[model samples]
Target: MWRAGLPGGLRAVFEGSPLSSGGSPRLLEGKVALVTAGTDGIGLGVAEALGVAGAQVFLSSRRAHNVQRAVETLRGRGLQVSGVTCHVGRAEDREKMVQAALDTFGAIDILVSNAAVNPHFGPILEADESTWDKVFRVNVTAAAMLVRLVVPHMEKRGGGAIVLMSSIAGYQPMRGLGPYGVSKAALLGLVGALSPELRRSRVRVNGVAPGLVRSRFSAALWEDEAVREQALKELGADRLGAPAEVAQAVLFLVSPLASFVAGQTLVVAGGAWSRL
Candidate 1:
């Protein structure tokens, strides 16, 4: 029931038999995944990919309307997906999201911390303290808190996988996005810090740093023709990366495919100079 030729050209991966020709091997079957800020862009793409891989997905966003629309969109494609409105920066909303996932799926096997914000776009020193607080609170503090909240549930279920959404800028900070880049860079360190603590519980933690992905959330970068061309030139990529392309990397990290991959930040930067 997955739509023919999904946005990422994943038709073969989600249509027909669970093991369709060149399709996913039902890697996440019988598992449940929770994706934050999953109503649109990269989050939605990841949710759709996980659902296609056979996980009952629990998605969350800050807006009720966005949550409703995403649930309806994925459900229309025959995926077992539920959603809730959760502003990740708020402790109460985060609690509600985790409880909702447990109430709906009983157990948690995967967590994709994709929610992030970049309200300021200027020189790092030019950014205000309040902006920095908001950035770190939503992009780093909230993600770490969510991990703490879900680890127990994952431990009870035996073991689990966690993927933090980062950015190529985390490695090579982009111009006019210094604070955003720094916040993403923090996640790279977080994977290392949390992996050791969570390993005892069989929880594997990793991160994904995507480059110049096309999304409404990133329209400022890609919608401007000159900027898009320049960025693509720097990346040596013929075109902008799709949200689904980044989602696929996320899928690999959260599935058995990445069982031995932990405490590392995989940069999907299309040959962009991202070494740090």
Candidate 2:
């Protein structure tokens, strides 16, 4: 059973923190990784973990200012990193992101497709075509295209790892986030379908399904008293999850530690009942 009740002060605590805090591992010492929607929240946390794990990271966000700030924040930690402005919904931006990574690091060893959007949070039946398009465009289509762009580079390097950021809502739908939930569910199938084909090129494809994590992206879920209470009751969660916890799972997926693990979705939902 997964335990909860992590103390509030221990929110951002992880294996290696503050860069100068020392004890950084060399698990991905010579790797090059690209993370989308990496300016903050889970994406930022995942980038930090990869950087601490010794992988040179190239991250992106839709806003140029966000991209710049994220790069500065991580660089302050003494981690090797760079950034680019990429609205994953745009194909041109996606191509630019891939090109930026290659231009900076020469080759890509890992790709973490962490970009997603939820334009509407109401009932699935009420959702319009544009809303659904936006959700899938960022959450699913963009991820697949990014993977397609990075696979050749990974193939050139012999083998690589890819992680798709999914959500527990995908397995068990969230009350009002129907469109978003459906998009995340698509990611699970995306990984399963791509893993075998990519494996032939020595590329491992996997997915991470995080529960209610404490971040701006999920502020609606964790910040509201009623919502928080309901989440605690339904998920049996003692406290909201920290992004670093999810990042640890991403680090493992992209690192050599999970070399044999592929086509699977690792649930980091604090024991929440998440089964397909």
Candidate 3:
């Protein structure tokens, strides 16, 4: 006979359960994500974070070899991941990227527009027309276009999140980073313009502005000992920010926890440039 008030039956099953995993279930389970320029640096870091959180992550780069290598590396870590080659500045390529995500995961819940190029670094007035156009096309127009392409697909899934990668230079123009900085500033405006429309459709639009991040793309800024020391002096952060640090802030903005967040730019610059 069972003792009075003894935990038994379903209670016994619960008490003796091996079915429960020790860690909490992933927050992003069953979601799908697309990260542009995800073959390296900050983009790759964001992709890895989303994958670890249980999202089926789709990444893209301009080079086929990089795409293959990134896909292999992420898969090796047992993440649900895939990749394709895409030049974000091209319309056809952007369409192909969106289509690839749909084809691979059925729906996309998160879109990280992390691709940008700084072709020229000099006085803003000294920049040639071609340089200006290239900077705007890749750093601003491409990000906007990618978001436009993903909106319908995200809508199909009832709602989704979009993160645009801006830069600290957007808030404070750095010398010799003229065109690139202007383009990043434009992204901030883009986020503001898109958020109201997106929220009504249950989608969220956000931006991340990182300062002095240590990435190959920004090596010219910090690779020199003298330049690095100067940047540290100007910026409050003693050390340059890591790609992964930026990725974590981005992950939070895209996650369900940020469901109520929209039309906001979370500066991940280690208190370098605080407006308020």
Candidate 4:
């Protein structure tokens, strides 16, 4: 049920799009994808990757402007995409996001819960109860609730793919990112628990644990020259990861390429020491 091409006035975007550049591959053509926090950084990268693969992407962010920009960028690439301003922590917003996908794409086949927060940067002990609450509410709770909203849509379609945004911090506790890391660890657990049940729905649940990537979200970890150097040596990586790298990992899981792969978290970190 995919639209074949762009409408009038927008044909040039697709004509000049990377899809025509031969750099784009169409592994997910006709699939419908919903990516939360799909405005920038890893989220935007993922949106483009999925769209380039042939999925009609529905992306969202807290800000209207960001959503608009992302939608325009994707369309300019000749990808069929739309956007909604959403606060993933809100129930109303979650409902709207799901409904928008169904309304626009006709069905939902993929979900990437990539929205996350790191409100606290200090030691876990000094972190207030409110900080913990907010972290779990957005990073963990909202993700789970959003899944609940989409599972039925996926079920109706006979099956679907879901990717949660976990992190390398989940496997090894990083000093300043304790609570955030803990929440990501919870996601790893969520993938395991949800997968077994989602199998009946024919839906597959997976996650990606990325290392320190070059994004505004992780600027604190890498922006400083001295700190970046120390962190790189500690992580045993030569350079930082790019959002495109992470997006490709996501693309594989959601695509038919990763069929039979479920409940497993792909570690996208570059030698960041993540086992067990």
Predicted candidate 4 versus true structure: per-residue lDDT over 1-276, tens digit per residue:
011222434345544555433555688887999999998889988898898888999999999999998898779878899989899988998999889888988998999999999999978999999999999999999999988999988888889999999998899888788899999999999999999999988899999999888888899989999888887777767777878778878989999889999999999888889875
The list of candidate 3 runs beyond 4 A from truth reads 1-25, 274-276
> What are the per-residue Cα lDDT tens digits for candidate 3 across 45-160?
88877887788999999999999998998888778999899999899999988898899889988999999999887788989999989989988999888888888888988999
- In model 4, what is the error at residue 237, expressed in angstroms? 2.2
Which model scores highest in TM-score? 2
lDDT of 2 by residue, 21-109 (tens): 26665789999999999988899888888898799999999899998998988898888999899898899999988999999989899
Model 1: weakest 10-residue lDDT segment is 1-10
lDDT of each: 0.88, 0.87, 0.84, 0.87
Compared with the true structure, the alpha-carbon lDDT of candidate 4 equals: 0.87
Error of 4 at 55 (Å): 0.0
Clashes of each: 0, 0, 0, 0
Question: How many pairs in model 2 have backbone atoms within 3 A of each other, for residues 3 or more apart or on separate chains, i.e. clashes?
Answer: 0
Return the lDDT, model 4, position 242.
76
Misplaced by over 4 Å in model 2 are 1-21
Which residue pairs collide, candidate 3? none
Per-candidate TM-scores read: 0.92, 0.93, 0.90, 0.91
| Per-residue C-alpha lDDT of model 1 across residues 1-276, encoded as one tens digit per residue | 223224445554444444332366888999999999998889998898899889999999999999999999899878899999999999999999999999999999999999999999878899999999999999999999999999999999999999999998888868789899999999999998999999989999999999888788889988889999987786666677777778878988999989998899998877787877
